[model samples]
Target chain A: MRILVAMSGGVDSSVVAGLLAEQGHEVVGATLQLYDHGAAAAKRGACCAGQDIHDARDVADRLGIPHYVLDREQVFRREVIGDFADTYARGETPVPCIRCNQTVKFRDLVALARDLGCAALATGHYARRVEGPDGAELHRAADPARDQSYFLAATTRDQLAFARFPLGDMPDKAAVRAVALRLGLAVAEKPDSQDICFVPEGRYDSLVARLRPGAVAAGDVVHADGRVLGAHGGIARYTVGQGRGLGAASWDGQERLYVAGVDAARRRVVVAPRGSLETGTATVGEVNWLIDPPSEPLRCAVKLRAREAPRAATVAWDAAAGLARVALDAPGIVAPGQACVLYDGDRVIGGGFLRAPGSVDRVPAAA
Target chain B: MPVLGLDANATEPLRPEARDAVLRALDQPGNPSSVHAEGRAARRLLEEARAAVATAFGAKPQDIVFTAGGTEANALAVRGLAPGRRVLLGATEHPAVLRAAPATAETIPVLPDGTADLAALEALLGAGGPALVCLMAANNETGVLHPVAEAAALCRRHGALLHVDAVQAAGRVPLALAGADSIALSGHKMGGPKGAGALLLRPGIDLAPLIAGGGQERGRRGGTEPLPAIAGMAAAALAARPEAAIRLAALRDAIEVGVAAAAPEARFPGRAAPRLPNTTSILLPGVAAETQVIALDLAGVRVSAGAACSSGKVAASHVLAAMGLGAEAGAAIRVSLPWNAAEDAPERFVAAWSAMRDRLSRRAA
Candidate 1:
């Protein structure tokens, strides 16, 4: 079978290509030249940018298969970058990568594979596509330490149909590296890519500044009591549940306050105690189901953020409204516009966007 | 019908004689730089090939310095000339030249027609000083010939040595050693094997050797000569005929017309300027070059984006960036053919291109 492997110049993708090639499949390795607008792309250690392409090409040569680098910068700018800027402008924290996977990387790449006359498009993502009695399903990888199912929740059905994850069944990062080493792949010892592909140093503010200079407004940081704490350099720099670098002037005897809200209209950071961070009920929009919608309020595990552990929750689906109402047993920092992925064990059930508090009419009797 | 490859700019298949020459050279036992009789025989072969390449490009045999390929040849040219000297480079030179040179290097922009800005080159030259001025005889992506003679004249006036990376222009266009102080060429671009290239320096020019080893190429470049590849390169260069370019140009024109008919929005860069007869950089807006290349490949046709060196990465070419082609660069695809492409090559290319357009249009809609 002819498989088109997506090599992102990261250890995982490089190893995936090597493993697949060793298995005797006709593998054509390809790397997507996503966005180069960020200065970090030129930096030495940055992955999936300038240097990564060369590295990917080198690996492809080593694998002895035809390799190609596809330029998807324009599509990336439209799907990922534009959406990122607009989301920030609208006071919502957006996962640019999720949008990239759904619109640019997976969808565009699978289409490219079809154009190349390949049977399937494979990536190094640590998530599984399993064929079960029910049908095709997305699942967490065997490696709990490196499971990336959370980041892949929004992948559409069409995109997932022709996708394969070779590293999905690997034991862990160590095992993957071992396989690479055993095969004499150069990237066996390469460190895992951690930073945002385009932003190696994690300075999102500078990137946002470059895109929309001075868009981050300097504003008042107010305490939960509505008293002016101090002046903030920008509201765009702050996120819900953040405590560090508040730049607050006064706090005589209170615990370090977290950012409870971002009032973009007035350009202010609403601060409060950690106790105020929890929200038992979250209304989610843009719902996508990997499994059939439950006939009743289904008891499931809901993860509100990437690293957060799944908490027991009762999920009620409103098909007509295209929303899911998640009632968590324990209150957590459920922010607006963040992805809320519902999982059953390692299987991803579905996901949706968490609506901001007060925007949607909450069921008064339920709370 | 034999495949009419219009993608020589990407890479030309090795000529049969060149392939035989490589195989013959590989059978020899001794290294050319060694002292034994077998080594002397190998050394003889090396010198003879070097002389052949020099004669083909109108230079002294001593001037031809072989390297791994055109990319390395380019790197040597850009980096060897007056280290620490402020470098001035043409906008459309390959990335190997741009990346190896200093970031502070002044860029001499190219006109929209792919001609080098001689005035800009002169301005940089006048500002002068221990400086290395780099330009290409022709643009790799656009096959548009640059004003090498005019620019070389400016370099001579300003007392700055000129380094012309003539990798794409050497055989297709007439080359004279007098135009530029130094020139770079790739054997593969002229139907030789990959991994063979030469840097031709003027007789009196002094350059810092990039690789130091047992004195070879007059101690300017190091490592045992890739005798097989060099012999093949020399053989390929000698076989190049004047009529090749004329024939290639006609085929290129036919292909361009066919493409334009299928996609009216398609653009040919440097169409009106003097260009390599075989190369065309076409821009199909609202469609990616990679997409079209892949589509063509699926239909038993092959083409490439400009600069096969950076083909795998999907970023817009730095050449295009230097030309100030922001979005248009993304839409550009290059097609190049050898003089030997089949008679039916253009028609087949047109059919493949039509199919690609239909597929892309449907995908877009």
Candidate 2:
């Protein structure tokens, strides 16, 4: 079978190409040159740069398969970087990677695979596709610790049809590393990359400064009661639930204040006690249903952050408004613009964007 | 054991004389910089090789400054040129030249035929003062020859020093360093060992040295020289002849005609323009270069997608991009033959290419 493997120059992608070729399948490795004009040797990892392409090619040569690099710099700038910068400008932190996967990586890659006459497109994502009685269902990987369902919840049913995840069945990272070592791959022991592929050092501030030089304006840091506590360099530097480096003098010392909300228009960071982080409900917009949309309010588990587990919740989809209002059984800090992924146990049902707290009308509970 | 060698662009098999010279140099125990008898012997071999390389390029022995390879030679040329003045380079210049020069340097455009545009270059030089002009003698991808002598003369009239990257042309094409201020050559490109190359610096042209370790290469470049590769490189240069050109050209012509018969729509760049006799850049539309290269490899034939140095990159070639070909650049497959390619090699390549073309055509239909 002919398989088109998407190599991102990361250790996982390198291993994916090696494994596919070793299995005697006609594998064609391709790396997407997402952002060609961007600075190289940046603090961020060189995921889709010239060096990455060289490394991917070296691995392809070692495996005795064909390798190609596709230039998608314009598409990346439009779909990922532009959206990310716009989201930040709107006083919200957006996951550009999720957008890239949904638009460029999967959608564009599927088209490339078809052009190459390959039956399917494969990636190194740590998510599984299970053939259940109903249809193909996306599920968490075997390794619970490294499961990436949060980032992949936005993937649609059609996009999942021609997709394959080789590392899905692997029990842990150690097992994957072991297979790479056994194959004598050059990147067998390469350290797993953590930060955003574009921002390796996690210095989003400098990147933002370079992009929008005068966009970040110094603003007042105010308490929940509207008392001016301190001044911040800019609201873009802060995120919900952040505590350290507040630059505020701790006079009262009652409790370390956490950023509860960002008022972009006023250029202010609203802070409150850590205990005040909890919220009873969240309204999700841009709802995407992996499974059929619930007929009514159904009890399930919802994950708001990457590290956070899916907690018990009641999710109600409003087709008229195109929104999903999720009521958590246990209150947590649900920030606006963050992903609200719904899960029925380990299977990802669907997800949507968390809307601002007071933007939706509350639905009454069951009498 | 028979090895299916596809990495010709990396380094060719060393000539027997070159190998023996390297072995002989390996027996000598003294550094060439040392003033002792053994040192003098090593120095004599090094100077003789330099002289041979100089004579091969129609240059004086003193004009040759030996360096690591083509990359360092290019870096020295680009970085050594006067700063603050505009630097003009051909769009197809190798990364060694491109990276060393500032990204904002003015690029001399290349025509669709893979030849440098003389009008654009003349205009660029005419409009600027104190410019360092760079143009390669032969493009590594399409094997297209640029008018370096013409460009160099134009630079000379404008008081600009021209650096010619003759790495691809050294043994394949006759080189005369009369008009250009400097020229770069790589040993591996001409069946010599790797890690040894030379930069031809015209007399009285002072420039900054990139490496300053020891007072080697007349205090222009520093570091311990790889004497074995140097000896091999000199012997290979001296032994290079034009007879291989005629043979390679005939084989290349046969391959081009056979491939064209098989795939009628395939386009070969520089078919009309001057190019390296042993190289051809064929474009197979709708079929990716990587796919064709692999198919050919499976059939015991080898080709490349653009230069082997930048083969793995998925991005379109900057040379192709500079020519405004855009995504079509991905369709280019470069087949570079060595000077001593076998008589039946072209037939073997044509047979393999026909099979691949049949498969691709059926798939397209």
Candidate 1 chain A lowest-lDDT run of ten: A358-367
Among all candidates shown, the one with the greatest DockQ: 1
Off by over 4 Å in 1: A1-29, A33-67, A71-97, A110-149, A157-276, A285-302, A307-332, A342-350, A355-367, B1-6, B27-39, B80-87, B119-133, B154-160, B309-311, B320-326
**In terms of docking quality, how is candidate 2 classified?**
incorrect
Q: Return the top candidate by lDDT.
A: 1
Kindly report the fnat of each predicted structure, to 2 decimals.
Answer: 0.62, 0.28
* Cand 2, B chain, TM: 0.95
| Candidate 2 lDDT by residue in tens digits, B104-162 | 79989988787899899889988967899889998887788898888878887888889
Tens digits of per-residue lDDT, candidate 2, A79-145, equal: 7877676666666677777888888888888866765568889998998988777677888888998
lDDT at residue A42 of model 1 (Cα atoms)? 52
lDDT of 2 at B305: 71
For model 1, residues B1-365, the per-residue Cα lDDT tens digits are 34345677767778887888889888887899888999999998898889889889889898889998898888888888848688888888888788879878988888877788888777777775867888888787888888888887887887777899888887787875486877888988888888789999888876777898877878888888899989999988888765687888888899899989988888887897888888888887877777777667646677777555324554566666566677777778888887578867888988878777777777668
